[model samples]
Target: MKFLKIGDRNLLYPIIQGGMGVGISLSSLAAHVAGNGGMGIISTAQIGFREDDFYKNPIVANLRAIKTELQKARDLAAKVFENSKLTAKFLDILKNYTPFIGFNIMVATNKYADYVIEAVKAGADIIISGAGLPIELPELVEKGMAVSGNEKRTCIAPIVSSRKSAKVILKMWDRKYKTTADAVVIEGPLAGGHLGFSYDELNELGADTMTSRNYKKDKYDAEIKEIIEEVRIYEEKFGKKIPVFVAGGIYTKEDIAHVMDLGADGVQMGTRFVTTYECDAPDDYKQTYIDAKEEDIVITKSPVGMPGRAIRNDFMDRLKSGPIPIRHCHNCLALSVCDRKTIPYCITDALCSAANSDESHALLFCGSNAYRADKLEHVEDIMLELTEDMN
Candidate 1:
């Protein structure tokens, strides 16, 4: 059964390569995913982190990264289009060349709020949002128009962690905007970076007890089933259905099948995708995950006021156990909703440092199975490896 029937497409392979930021999972990873019969997502984040001499404005150095990333995504499209050897002879050159290129943009970013709109304008097939509540996604996307209508002008999918969150989003979407989610991704606690669960929740679920298990268990947590039922309620209320995709800590082919069995239309994977050759992440970043051990995975709070998962590294140790007072929140202007007014260090600084390959202060986001990715390979072979387990 196909889980990816958002508007028009029913992707046979429910594999959605999770989007990584700052040139981690750029166009090459996504392009190869689409080429191999899966949905590939491009992260429209500090994407230009590796642009060749692409610094013009010193004041907006923050935005310079985004420009570079977008350009990289575009350049990636060109390369994939050329390498496919499929001439522009087809009438639907886009459909023939770019199989399902989606963009994942964080709503809490200091970058442009209408980043998804820009992606739509850039001919992106879909936009996956996370990091914070994407309350204004529909209006943001509505402001622009798509170049073609293979699907809606452009589709938006907000990642949710619980059924309550799903219901709240649908209600907000219905009452405030009357728009429908093209799709939804239910991200569990196993995801990297900003987590959907709180520290207490992570602890209560036994996630805290098993940090050294090499992987976390979302299998019996019922997040996917709960989200499916919640989305069904929205469908019943609004008389429309929204496809549901599940992600977070999913690693094996059986994991994909289990989610599909539980009623998900798609599944998103982040950590394993980092091992791919087409992934735009730096060599050090990829190797870091490969070198990690089960005990190295840790859950900590983000500057955004959310609990997140990452590999325990020197930077985290410095941030946690340092003698300095961790009471500076220079960039905390309600950018991301958190209980605290400020945090010791700016999350933006840490993440940006990681994106720039500053391993000393870098924050590496990974799925629960991040330590399990032991080798590096090309995107095609990686996809085939995970899918082969299903076959």
Candidate 2:
């Protein structure tokens, strides 16, 4: 397969394993993908929820775990190389030319910029910020890099949903920070978790949140094409190629090929990876996807004031009935004041429960094609299947 170059780093496989948070994608999944030549991203959303003192002090726990997770990915990658029968020359090439570890920090998180700064200082090779337009991302990266005292460039990318968003971010960064993005992830409305589109827009496409499934190709494809074209304009301005990756509903080799045909440099997939053996989520959590049906995947309201796609379950049914009580603030979002009274439920607690495999009570987030997952498979096998035709 042809390689993808993001800044100074050359990825052997153009695919990026999307970051799933709470406790879904961690060192095990990220390291395995990186070891196999794909960019692996560890999600920083509630990353420290597993720490013993997390409830007492969530920020400190998340910061400490961020450093620990990145280091663990590096350690695991080194072990993979040392134990392999591949020649040292090729191993050395990989070690020098590629970055195996990265962090996924949502722009909507509590102390969003702080997380980016801390993650960079903790040795993240790349920072993928999403869930909102990361306008100040470039400035934070500049400061973070300076603090790290590392001469090497740490790649910064933003996850965008529309051409307007892409243009706005690129223009702002160029005018203010005098910098351009290293990469861009174009996420469509069909993506799992919090969607980029509003409820009305999503409904206008006949997206039956309760039952029928549909993919409005014309609407999404046009947006993606426009964004890619906008990126090309910046590429010409900077006299450098900036890679664009398409995400959302990408489940098979055909899906990847289709997007590449649309001028995408690569793809970022999160849901497919969740059912992999290496995914950090509990077995029952993986089982949720495997057991789901087309009708089970529904559009729901996120506590963060955004719409999300999730599996229809008893917990969700109860939430629909009335607002569930918020026992304590999880300190998940970067807001001056959290209006728990207005929100339906606590996202952090729900996701954490899902990660722990609490099927009856947890909110199960999934991709549009999650119902297609029949069983758990190895990360290596999934990667090969996705890239077999490309190679």
Candidate 3:
């Protein structure tokens, strides 16, 4: 496999382990991917809650969790830092083992602006933000983080739904931000969690009307190709080869081969990593993916004003029948455009429950192929499987 570079640093494997939230891909998995020659990304979405004190203040839960997760990532990184096994004495030496440590910060999350800054301080090399138009990302990346006691390059990678989104950011960067994008991710309908489609567009695409859940189709959809084509147009206009990565429903080596054949620089996987040994999600969470049936994975609408794909379970069945439960509201009022009361369940409760392995009420975000996951394997083995026969 060919190594890829982010500015001056080198990543031995262009492969990027997708960031999963609420304790899915934690330091263990991220460190392993980086250790095994790939770009490992730690999702900063709910990082801090791993701490015992994460939930004392209900409103600042995400903030507390971010702090906890960053520390946990460092703690779990002990093995990767061992002198007997490729030790990284300086913080920058961490670049060699897992050079491209990234953070997936959702623009939709509460306190998102502050969260982005925290990721940089935690030594994130790439900041990939999605769930909405992250117009302020360039400004965040420019804030800079310290490594080797000096400011390091922080790459901002935005997830785009269409060419229009790509063009808008590029124009904004050129005209207003005075910065060019370091990279971008083209996420499709098959991805886990949120989508970029509209009500009518999704309806025409066969989305269920009463509920916001999505379904699976046998063949590749045309919308994804359109998104990729749009991304390419922006790459051409920018006059810079901004690395384009793709995600969603990537299940096997054949799937990886196909995307590579289509000209994507790399692929990102969230569901696949969830089953790996290093994944920080609870064993039951991992088991859910292992034992799931093909038809069990479904999409649902989040009170957070987003359409998400997840496993069909009792929690959702309960949502449609009764008044949506609300034990507490963070009221962080993170997004100016969002209405906080519209949020159904405290994402904090449901996700943390699932992370703790209580599947009865936890919100499970999964890709269409999550049910097709037959076994749990090491992250490196999956990497070997995908790249073994690569040309």
Q: What C-alpha lDDT values do all the predictions have?
A: 0.69, 0.84, 0.69
Model 1 ranges off by over 4 Å: 1-3, 9-12, 50-97, 146-152, 209-220, 236-241, 323-342, 389-391
22, model 2: CA deviation in Å? 0.8
Instruction: List the lowest-lDDT window of 10 residues for candidate 3.
Output: 81-90
> Which 10-residue span in candidate 2 carries the lowest summed lDDT?
80-89
lDDT score of residue 121 within candidate 3:
68
Q: What TM-score goes with each of the models? A: 0.82, 0.95, 0.85
Q: Which whole-number lDDT from 0 to 100 does residue 361 have in model 3?
A: 82
Native-referenced Cα lDDT, model 3: 0.69
The alpha-carbon lDDT assigned to residue 298 of candidate 2 equals 91
The candidate scoring highest on lDDT is 2
- Runs off by more than 4 Å, candidate 2: 81-99, 208-212, 336-338
Among all windows of 10 consecutive residues in model 1, the one with the lowest summed lDDT is 324-333
Q: Which parts of model 3 are misplaced by more than 4 Å?
A: 58-98, 144-149, 206-239, 332-338
Supply every candidate's count of residue pairs whose N, Cα or C atoms clash at under 3 angstroms: 5, 0, 9
